[model samples]
Target: MKRLKLLVTLAKKGAIGEKVKITLRELADELGISPQSVLRLLDEMEKEGLVSKEVLGRKTYVEIDHEGLAFLESLCDAISEALYNGVIIGEVISGIGEGAYYVKQYAHLIREYLGFDPYLGTLNIRVLFPKTVFDALCGVRPVVLPGFTKDGRTFGDVKAYRIRINDIEGAIVVPSRTVHPPRIAEIIAPVYLREALNLKDGSRITLRVVKG
Candidate 1:
């Protein structure tokens, strides 16, 4: 399980760079493994050239190799598909009848699985992974669904979904503005709901869940 996580980390980061600078103690905590186990994993990864370590004075750092990055991305894409339920829980913010908005802070960070539409240009979803699923993946990787973009990168909204339901029972949202465009922020993935939203092949524009 611990070995699997290191591999996942490599896959997600693309490349770990020449000097991966997390302390041994931090690494252990972040990976949810023992420090001793970390040493073992690092040793194995170094042997494989999946990672390379650098020592600066008394400090040590490690980063993923190019080959390791490629390997991890493929694995992540596959795991993402099979790991979670298909049903996605969210609301379309822009469509909200009048004056609805998801708080910006909630939308931007990995607090909850909130979903907002482009209507707000940002979103937040309370992380809603089930305890069982989340627990199983405890050390598999740090939280955050695969492929979510922060850092002001925009794709062609190609992965859009035509949400069929307007179930805003507990969904909260904010409106659009110049500084903050509407977006899906708070999103929850109920297994069956996610399965139902099982995106079809080549379907673009993921459903912007938070909409007023």
Candidate 2:
């Protein structure tokens, strides 16, 4: 875990697939370890082909290899799968009054792909713990909502995941273009979830994935 943490720190320093100059003392301070320990860990990582280091005079350059990035990705997948497990908790929040317009545009596609006629608007939820709704939904396949152009305006594709909230079936839509933050989850159901569930702003909700 120490090695992995060190690798993560290096990646954060813009060392992925590109050389970045850094000092042992800087790395040691970031990792809360001694410079000698950091050097030993880097030696092991270099031998394992996870990182490559080049020393020129007094400057040292570091880069994360492809294998190192893959290792981090696999770790992320494992953690997401273990923590999320197709369930998400959040609090209901209001949208920016644009959900109705976008939902109207994608109504046909939603009915065709998700098998439900979505209501005019969406229910916005602020994800509780995970960094983003996309991260929380990692490892779960999404129903693709293909984009189309109308009246010279192009709409980007979206990813949807079927979920159940309080026994009401709905799907969360993630747009290719969004002004909302990663924590916001936009949900669409056959009916208005707020009225149906008696939900108000700050209402806590649990969403369970419905496997197709």
Candidate 3:
């Protein structure tokens, strides 16, 4: 588990295909362990073909090996399957009043890729789970809404995951450049979910992944 955690940490630091210069002390600090323990874990991972390390002068560079990448991908698949087979619970929350504007901006793309014309606004939910709501979307493929330039303004790409809430079909939209935290989910559906479901702040909701 420590080796896997180390690999995940390295991957999060953008060390998948390319080398990332990191120190044992920095890694130890991040993992909350001693530098010697980190070194031992790295040695084990290296022997298992999970990572590659190189040294230059006083610098240490590390990268995830192919096997490491494969391992992470498999883990993601397993997590996704487990999440899909179950359900995630969250509480209704209010947004910063930007959902309507963003939804209107990507209306066309949402209709094209998500197969529905979303309502004017979104239903914000604060996921109460292991951590980020993204945990439920581990290996699931998302419908990518390409960014566009309009009226001298540029919009970033968005990723949409199909979901079902109380038997109502909807989607969770995640903007590439977003101010929202990982625990917050912005949902879009064909109708106003708040009115349709009679929801309010602190209302608990269940979300189920709809596999395509």
Compared with the true structure, all predictions reach lDDT values of 0.43, 0.90, 0.89
1-212 in candidate 1: lDDT tens per residue?
77668766543544355555656776688798888888888888889877887778978777787767777778767776565433343333332322223223233432343343223322232223322222222223223222334468531211122222234222222212222223233322322232344433222223222222
- Write down the worst ten-residue block by lDDT for model 1: 155-164
Best candidate (score: TM-score): 2
What's the candidate order when arranged by decreasing lDDT? Answer: 2, 3, 1
Which segments of model 2 are wrong by more than 4 Å? 95-122, 136-160, 173-183, 190-192
Choose 1 or 2, whichever is better by lDDT.
Answer: 2
Candidate 2 residue lDDT tens string, 28-133: 9988899999999999999998999999999999999988989999998888678877788899988989999999999999999999999999999999966678
Residue by residue across 36-110, what tens digits does model 3's lDDT show?
A: 999888888989999999889989899999999999999998886665463668999999998899999999999
Would you list the rank order by TM-score, best first? 2, 3, 1
Q: Per-prediction TM-score, please?
A: 0.40, 0.69, 0.62
Q: Which prediction has more favorable TM-score, 1 or 2?
A: 2
Model 1 sits at a Cα RMSD from the real structure of: 14.7
Candidate closer to the true structure by lDDT (higher is better), 2 or 3: 2
RMSD of each: 14.7, 4.4, 7.3
Provide the lDDT at 173 for model 2.
90
